[model samples]
Target chain A: MTMYVVGHKIPDSDSICGAIALAYLKNQIDEPAIASRLGELSPETAFILDKFGFEAPEFKESYAGENVYIVDHSELTQAPDDIAQATIVGIVDHHKLGDLTTSTPLECWIRPVGCSNTIIKMMYDFHNVEIPKDIAGIMMCAILSDTVIFKSPTCTTADIKCVEALAEIAGIEDYKALGMEMFKVKSAVEGTPVRDLVMRDFKDFNMNGNKVGIGQLEVIDLAVFDDIKAELAADIAAMKNEGERHTMMLLLTDIMKEGSEVLVISEDDTLIERAYGKAPTDGKVWLDGVLSRKKQVVPPLQDAFA
Target chain B: MTMYVVGHKIPDSDSICGAIALAYLKNQIDEPAIASRLGELSPETAFILDKFGFEAPEFKESYAGENVYIVDHSELTQAPDDIAQATIVGIVDHHKLGDLTTSTPLECWIRPVGCSNTIIKMMYDFHNVEIPKDIAGIMMCAILSDTVIFKSPTCTTADIKCVEALAEIAGIEDYKALGMEMFKVKSAVEGTPVRDLVMRDFKDFNMNGNKVGIGQLEVIDLAVFDDIKAELAADIAAMKNEGERHTMMLLLTDIMKEGSEVLVISEDDTLIERAYGKAPTDGKVWLDGVLSRKKQVVPPLQDAFA
Candidate 1:
C-alpha cells in the first residue's frame, strides 16, 4: 500500500523536514511511503533543503488513499481538504489536537515537544533505524528553525538533546553558527513583493466557525515592515477577500526582542483588544513574548470568539 | 497523582471490566490508577462483577484532575461531560475516535479490535505483568460479551487468541456455556418497564450534527418484542421529546437466529429506509447478519446522513 506522508499546509522547516524523516523511517521499516508537502516551503526551509542534499517535496492539494500517514499536524482544518475522506492510519505531530476524528482506530504518535523533528529523532532511536547524514542535517535544521536556535520559548530539552546527537551525525561542529546562517535567510525579505512576503509563513485556521489567517515575518530589523506597512495592509485585505476570513493578521515579529507587532484587520477592531486584553495603536498591537502562533495566538483568539 | 480510569457513559461488560483490567495493569506498572465507571452498569456487567468477586467501581459525574487515563471508548459523547476540562494523560481504547482533543500530547493507545479488553490483555503481555485470576475472569467476560462469544463480525484472531489465553487463566473450561449463562440475563426482559427496557443498553450518538440513538437487547426469544412493539415505539418517541434526537432505534437481536429485528422511530421514516435499504413494517425492520452496532450500524447511518 502506498502511503502519502505529509505535513500541514504552510510548510515550515519542521513540517517539511519531519515529513521526509518519517517517510524515510516508514520505508526503512518495510512500509511503502512517499514524502509530500501540503504547501510551498518558506525561504528558510528552502535554504535548509539546499544546504542539505535534499530536494523540496512535491506539493499536492489533497490526498485520497486507503492508508495515509499525517505527519506534524493534527488539526483537521490545517490538513488537506479531503483528509476526512481518507483513512488516516497514523499521525506524527507535536502540536495540540483539533477537530480530527477517524472512523477506524489507527496509530497516533503525538508528542508535546518543541519541534516535530525532535520527536522523529526519538522515533528513529526507538525503532533502531539509523539516521543518514543528509536526513540528519535536515532534521537538525528543522529543530534549529522551529526552536529558533534554542532561544524560542517553545524549545525543550528534547530539542536540545536531539540537536546535539544530530549535529554529531551530520558532522556539524558549531550548531550555533549554523543556526545563525539559517536565520539570515529569514531576513531576506527586503525587496520581495508584499504578497509573497506576507504569504511566506502564513497559516489558516478555523476558529468559532470563522476562518482565521495569520502570517509571521521574523526579522532582525523591525523597521522594514514600517517602510512597507501600507503595501502589507493592502495585501492582507486582498487575501481576506479570497473568502471566509473573519480576521487576518501579519505578525511583524522582532526576533531578538522575542515579541511581535501584530498588524490587525477584521470586521471589528475591538476583537483584537478583546483577544489580548490590550487596545491596538494605529491598527497594531504589541504582543510581548509571543513567538509561536500555535501556542500564543489561537488559544486567546478562540476564547475571545467564545 | 491518582487517575480515575473509566470507560464510556452507559458502561457495558467490556467498558466496565476493561476499566478494571487497565487500572490493575497501570498500578502494576507503578502508575497510581483507580478503576471507575461513568454511569450505571448493565445487568450482564453486574453479573460478571458479582461472579468475579469484584466490587462495582465508584460512579462519578465528571473528572477534573491533573491526569486521567481513559479506557475502552473514544469520543466526547461517550466520555464524561467534563472530560474536556481534564488533562488526559493516557487513553487505551478500541472504537473509532470522535471530537475529543487534548491540549497536551500524551500516550494514546487505540486499536480496531472487537473488545477493549483484548488491547488491555496485549498490554499486560507487553509489560510482562502477570494477570491475576480475578482480573482475568473479568477480562474474559468483557471479551466474551463484546465479541458475542467470538461470533461478532468485529472479532479478530487477536481477540479469539486473547479469549483462549484468558479462558485458561480464569479457569473457564467451557466459554460457550459461560456465554450462554450471560445471554440468559439479556433474555429476562418480561417485568421490565418499556422505557427501562428501551433504555437498558442504549447509546446516543451525533451523526452529521443530528443526534441519533441505537439500543440493543440480545435475547433468545424475538416474540417478547413482538408482544409490545407499540410500547417500545412510544418510549422512543418520549426519548426523542427529550430533544436532539433525529432518530431512535432498538435492536431486538435474537442470539440464536443471529440477526436483529430493528424497531425504529424517527421524525423521518424515509431516512431509515435510505440507511438500511428497507422500509420498516410498522416501525420494525429485519437486518440479517448484523451483530455489531459500531461496525455495522454507525458507518452506514453516517453515510446516509452525509
Candidate 2:
C-alpha cells in the first residue's frame, strides 16, 4: 500500500515542506509514499513551493484505512477528522507530546529542534539517501521559516546545522535573504480576507478538555495589522463561538520586534493573565520575547488550563 | 541537574538493560545521567546482568522534579508514581504510543522494532558512539529476551541486525545458546511466591479509563505452571482487587511449543473473546503461535476495549 505523508491542519511552511521532503526521503529508502496536506497551504508555504519549482501536495482530509505518516504536529485536534480510522505508521514532529495514542508500535522521530525538516534531514542521513535539490531547498526554507531566521527561542544547533547542509545541497549562498523574501510574502495580507488570514496559521488545542484556538501572523512589522485589528478580534470571537472553543487567541508577531501582540477572546480573560502574569488591557497584551508558540505560549497556557 | 534514565515497572530484561544502555549513551554525549529502575529485576534479567558482569540499576520509585528519559515503555500506568511531576526529557521505546504528554519538545526515538535495544543501537550508530563490551552484552541479551530468540512476531529485520552487531561487539559467538540459558533461569519459578512470579513481568494499562493488568511468564515447558495455575489465578484476582484493576491476565508461554496458555480474570471475560475470536474454556484459553504479548496480545485487547 502507498503510504501518505501529511501534516497538521492549517499547514505551515514546515508542515507542508516537511511532508514533501519526508515523502521523498521515504520513497528513496523504504516505501512508496506520497505527500499530502490536510488543509490549504499558507501563503508562505505556497510561495516557498513556487520558489522551489514544486507543486502543492494533494489536499486530503479523510485518511481512513490508509497508512499515514504525520509530520510537524502530533495533537489529535490538528489531525484529520478520520485520523482515528487511519493507521498512523509514523510521526516526525518537533512539538510537545500530545494526547495521541496508538495500538501498535510506530516510527516516531521527535526532537527538540525548531523544525520537523531538521529531523527529516537527519532521517535522510541515517538512511544514506541523497536528498533532491528542490526538496533540500524547501526543507531549508522550512527550517528558516520555523526558526524565524534562527531568532526564535525554539531554534537549536541541529536546526542551524541542518539548514546549512541543506543550503549547500540547494546551492543557495544567501539563504537568510531568501527567508526574508519568504516572510515578506507571508506578510502580504493587505487584501486577504480576515478568515483566510486567521486560518492560514491557525491551530486548535485540546487543553484540559477545553478547545483552545491559537493563530499566529508573523510579519516584519506589527503595523500591518493596525487597521484590521478590531476586525481580526471580532472574527476570532465569532470563530470561538462557531468552533465552540473556550478561548481564541491571535498572535500578531513582529519578527523584527521579537515579540507578540496577543489578542484574546475567552470565557474568562484572566486565563491569559494567569498564563503570562500580565493582564490584558482591552483584550490585548504585549508578550515580550514570545516568538515560539510551542515554547513561549502553549506550555504556560496548558499549565494554566491544568 | 543530573538526569535519570528508567524503564517500566516490574522491570523486564529489555527495560532494565535499555535504561542502563541509554544512560550510558546519554552520558557519553550530553549530560550527567544515571540508570534507575522502577522495580526489581526479573530472574532472566538478573541472569543476563550477572553474565554481563554488571550490577542491577539503582531502584528508585519516584522521579519527582527529576529529568527522566524513559526506555522500553511509554504508558503512564507503567511509569513511576510521580511521573507527572517529572520532566520527561526523552523516550526510546518499542511499544504502542501511550497517553503521556510532555510540556516541551522532547527527544523521542520510538520504532516498530521488537526491542528498545535495537533502537538504542541505532541511536549509538547515529551519534557515532561505541558501545562498551558489557553494555553490548546486556543489550544483545535484552534483544534476545524481547524477541524470544528470534521467534516472536514482533521481531523485525532491524532487531536481527542489531543483535548481530551487538553480539559481535560483545564477542559472543553463541548468543542463541546464551538466550536459552537465560530462559532456563527464567523458567525456574518453583518455590518462588505466586505473587512474585506474577509480578515478575507484569504491566498495567489504562484501557479506556479501566486499569487492566497483564503479566507474561515464558518458559520451556507449560507443565511447570500446571500445579500452580489456580494459585496464580487467585493471586492475580487478589492483585486486581488491591490495585482496583478491572481485569488481570497471565500468559503462561511455552517458548518451545510456540504457544501460550492464557489465564484470564476480568470483569467481563467476553472482552477476550471479542479480541481473539476464541472464547475461553473455564477462564483459560490455549492460543497457538502466540509468543509476543506486545504483538499478538495487547494490541487486540486494546482494540476490543476501545
Candidate 3:
C-alpha cells in the first residue's frame, strides 16, 4: 500500500519538512510514500529547500477529493479524497485540530510541538532511521521557522531536542544567527507590494464579533518600519474595504528592539484604543517590549473581542 | 518583584491553563506571580475550568507596559511588557516566537509539545508538585482541546503521558469520551453567525502571492449545513464585494460522515475546479471520506494555487 504524506495550505517550512520526513520514515517501513506540498512554497521555504538541494514537492491544492495523510493543519477543510483506496494511516502536525473524517484504520499523531518536523524527528529517533544531512538541515530550518528559533510560545522540549540533534547533523551552530540571516535576506521591504506584505505571514482573529486580520513583518533595522508604514496603512484600509469585517493591524517589528511600531487601520477606534491605548502619532503605537504577536498582542485583543 | 503570566489573543484553554500553571510554578519558587487571561475563555475552555472549579483569571486588553510571561500566542502583536520593574524571568509557551525584547536574566522555555500545559506538567513532575485534581482536570482538558483529543496532527508522546497522568488525578477514566463530549458541545453549529463562526479559530496563511482566507465549522448533523451554507454564501459574496483579492472557502464537516461538503465561494471558479474536480451544482462540493482540512483539502487547494 502506498502512503502519501502531505501538508496544509500555504505550505511553510514545517509543512514541507514534515511531509518529507514522514515520507522518508514511511518508506523505511516499506510503505510507498511520497512527500507532497499542499501549496506553493513561500520564497523563504523555497530558499531553504534550495539550500538542501531539494526540489519543491509537487503541489496538491486540496485533499478535498483525493486520499492522503494530513499534517500541520486542522480537519475543517477536508475534501473528497477516497480514504478506502488509500487509508490515512498516520498524521503528524503542530497546529490546532479541526474535525477529521477517517474511515479506515488511522494512527494519528498531532502534537502542539512548534513544528511537524519535531514529530518526524521523534519518529526517526524512535525508529533509528538515518536522516540525510540535507533533510536534517531542512528539519532544523523548519523547527526554527515554526518556533521562531525557540522563541514562540508553541515550542516544546522535543522541538529543542530535534533542533539540537539536527544542528549537529547539519553542522550548524546558533540557529538564531541563521534565523537572523534568513530574516535579513527576506526583510528587504522595498518593491514588495503592500498587499503582499500585509498577507505575508498573516492570520485571522475574531475580534468583537468581527474578523480582524493581522500581518507581521520582522526586520533588522527599524528604518524599514517607516518605509512600509504608509503603504501598510493604505493596504490595511484597502483590506477593510476588501471585506475584512473588523480591523487590520500591520506590525513592522525590529527584532533587536524586541518591540514594534504598529500600524493599525480600523473602522473602530474603540478597538484601537482597547488594544494599544490611543493610536500613536505617525500611525505607530509603541509596544514597550512586545515582540511576538501570539505572545503579546493576540491575548489582549482577544480579550477585547470577548 | 511580581511576575504576571498571560497569553496571546483569543486565549484558548492552553493559554489560560498555561498561565495558571506557570503562576503556580513560579509561586513554588517564591516568586510573586499572578495568572491573567488576555481574553474571555471560549465555551470549551469555560467548560474545562468550570469542571475543575477554578475561577477564570482577570481579563486584560493588552500586555503593553506590563511585566509578563507570554504563553500559547507569540509576541509579534505587542511589545514585551517592561520587565525592568518586575523581572520577567522566564517564558513558557507552545506557539511560534516572534521578536522578543528582554535582556535581563531571562530563562525562556519554548517547547513544541502538544500543549503548554504539558510543559507545566513536566515542571510539576520535575519539582514533584502534587497534581491538584482541579488543576489536573483543567490541564487535561486543555490538552484535549488543543490536540483535538489526539486527533490533531500535533499530538506527541509527552502530550499523551501528561494527559494520562492528569486523567488519573482528575478521576476521569475515559478522556476520549470526555473529549468527544466537549467537542460535541463545542461543535454544535446552531444560531452562530456565519462570519463569527468563520473567523473564530481561524488562522491566516500566505498563499502563492494571493490573500486567501479559509474557515471551518464542525457540525454534528447535516441538517444545519443548509443554513450555514446559505449564510456563508452571502458572507463570501459580501467579502468579495468588499474587495478581498483572493478566494474564500468554507467547510461544513460532519464528524459522523467522516467527510466534508465544501462550499466554494470565490471570484475564480477555476480555482475551485482545480481543487475539487468540478464545481458543485449548488457550489457545494461533496468530499467523501475526506476529513481533515490540513491533510485532505488544503494540500490540494494549495496545489491548485501553486
Candidate 4:
C-alpha cells in the first residue's frame, strides 16, 4: 500500500517541505510513500520548490482509508476533512501537542525545535540515509522560513545546526539571500484577493470548545498592508461568521521592525486583552517583538481561553 | 532543576525500567534527570530489579510545578493526578495515543513496538551512549515480560532484536530461563489480597467518555486462578461501582495455554459481545490467542463503545 504523507491545510513552507522530506525518508526505511498536501501552497513554498528544482506535491484532502504520516502540524482543525477515518501511521511535528488520538501505536517524533524539517534532518542522520541535494535545499529553506532567518524566538540551536549541515549538502553558501527572495514572493500582496490573503498562512484553533482563527502575513515592511488593512479586517469578519468562530485575527508582521500589528474581529475583546495584557484600540493592537505566531501568539490565547 | 521520569499509575516492568533507561540517556545528553515511579512495584518488576542489583525508583504521586517525562503509557487516567499542572517535558511510550495536550513543544518518542524499552534502546543507539550492564539486564527483562518471552502478538522483530542486544550486554547466556524466573515470581498469588491481585498491572481507559478499567494477570497455567476467579470478579465489580466506571474486566492469561480467560463486570454486557464476538456466560469468557490488551483488546472495545 502506498502511504500518503501530508501536511496541514493552508500549507506553509515547513508543512509542504516537511511532508516531502518525511515521505522520502519513510520510503527509504519502511513503506512506499507519497508526498501530499491538504491545500494550495503559499508563494513562499512555491518559490522554495522552484528554487530547489522540485515540484509541488499532489493535492489530496480526504484520506479515509489510507495510511498517513502527518507532518509540520497535528491539530485536528489543521488536518483534512476526514482525518478521523484515516490511519495515522506517524507524525513529525514541532508544534504543541494537539488533540489527535490513535487506537494503535504510531511513530511520533515531536521535538521543541523551530521547524519540522530540523527533526526530519535528525531522522535522516539516525537512519544513515543520505539526503539528495534538491531535497536538502528545500529543507533548508523550510527551516529558514519557519524561523524567519533565525530571528523568531522559536529558532533553536538544533534548527541552526540542521540548516548549516543542509546548506553544506545543498552547496548553498548564501542561503540567507535565498530566504529573502522567498519572503519577497511571500510579501506580494498586490492583485491578490482579500480572502486569499487572509487564508494564506491561516490556522484555526479550538480553544476550550470555542473556535479561534488566526492568520499571519509576514512582510519586509508593515507599510505594505497600510492600504489593505480595512479590506483584510472585513474579510476576517466574514470568515469569522462563516466559520462561526468566536474570534478571528490577522497578524501583519514586519520582519524588519521585529513586531506585529494585529487586526482583531472578536465576540469579546476582553479575551484578547486577557491574553496579551494589551487592549485593542479600534479593533487593532501593536504587539512588539512578536514574529512567531506558534511561539508568541497561540499559547497565551489557549491558556486564557482555558 | 531535576526532571523526573515516571510511568503509568500501576507501574509495570516496562514502565519502571523505561523511566530509568530514558532518564539515564537524558542525563547523558541534556539535563539532570531522575527515575521515579507512580506506584509500588509488581512482583515481576521487583524480582527483575533485585536480580539486576538495582533499586526501585523514588515513589512520587504528584508532579505539580515540576518537569516530567512519561514512559510506557500516555493516557491521563494512567498519569499522576496533578499531571495537568506539571510541565510535561517529554514522552517515550509504545501504546496508542492518549488524550494528553501540551502548550509547549515536547520530546515525544512514540512507536508501535511491544515495549517502550525497545524504543529507548533505539534512542541509546541513536545517541551512541553505552548502557550499563545492570541497566541492560533490567531492560532485557522488561522487554521479555512485556512480550511474554516473545510469545505475545505485540512482540515485533525490533523487540526481539532489542532483547538479544540487551542480553549480550548483560552477559546473560540463558535469557529464556531468566524470563521464566521472572514469570514465576509474577505468577505467585497465594496469600495475596484479591484487590491487590486485581490492581496489579491495571490500566484505565476513557472509551468515548465512558471510563473502562482493565487488568491483566499472566500466569504459567490457568489453574492458578481456579480458586480465586469468584473473588476476582467480586473485586472487579466493587471497583467498577466505586469508581463509577461503565465496565471493568480482568484477563487471566495463561502463557502456557496461549489464551486468556476473562472475568468481566459491565453495565452493558453487549459491549463485550460486540467487541469480541462472544457472549459471556456467568460473567466469564475464554478469549483464545488474546495476549495483548493493547492490540487485541482495547481497540475493538473502544470502537464498540464509540
Tens-digit lDDT track of model 2 for B220-273: 999999899999989988999999999999999999999999999899878999
Q: State TM-scores per candidate.
A: 0.81, 0.98, 0.49, 0.97
DockQ of candidates 1 onward, in order? Answer: 0.45, 0.91, 0.03, 0.88
RMSD of each: 4.3, 1.3, 14.7, 1.5
Q: Report how far off residue B186 is in candidate 1 (Å).
A: 5.1
Residue A159 error for model 3, in Å? 3.3
Q: Can you write out model 4's per-residue Cα lDDT over B135-218, one digit (the tens) per residue?
A: 999999999999999999999999999999999999999999999989999999999999999999898899989999999999
Candidate closer to the true structure by DockQ (higher is better), 3 or 4: 4
Return the clash pairs for model 1, or none.
none
TM-score of 1: 0.81
Model 4 chain A: weakest 10-residue lDDT segment is: A72-81
DockQ of 4: 0.88
Model 3: CA > 4 A from native? A1-4, A75-91, A95-113, A151-158, A206-209, A275-283, B1-306
Off by over 4 Å in 2: none
- Local distance difference test, each candidate: 0.83, 0.92, 0.68, 0.92
Q: Give per-candidate clash totals.
A: 0, 0, 73, 0
* Global lDDT of model 4: 0.92
Residues B127-237, model 1: lDDT tens digits: 799999999999998898888888888898989999899999989999888988998886887778888788777888888888998988888778877778788888888
- What value does the lDDT take at residue A251 in candidate 1? 91
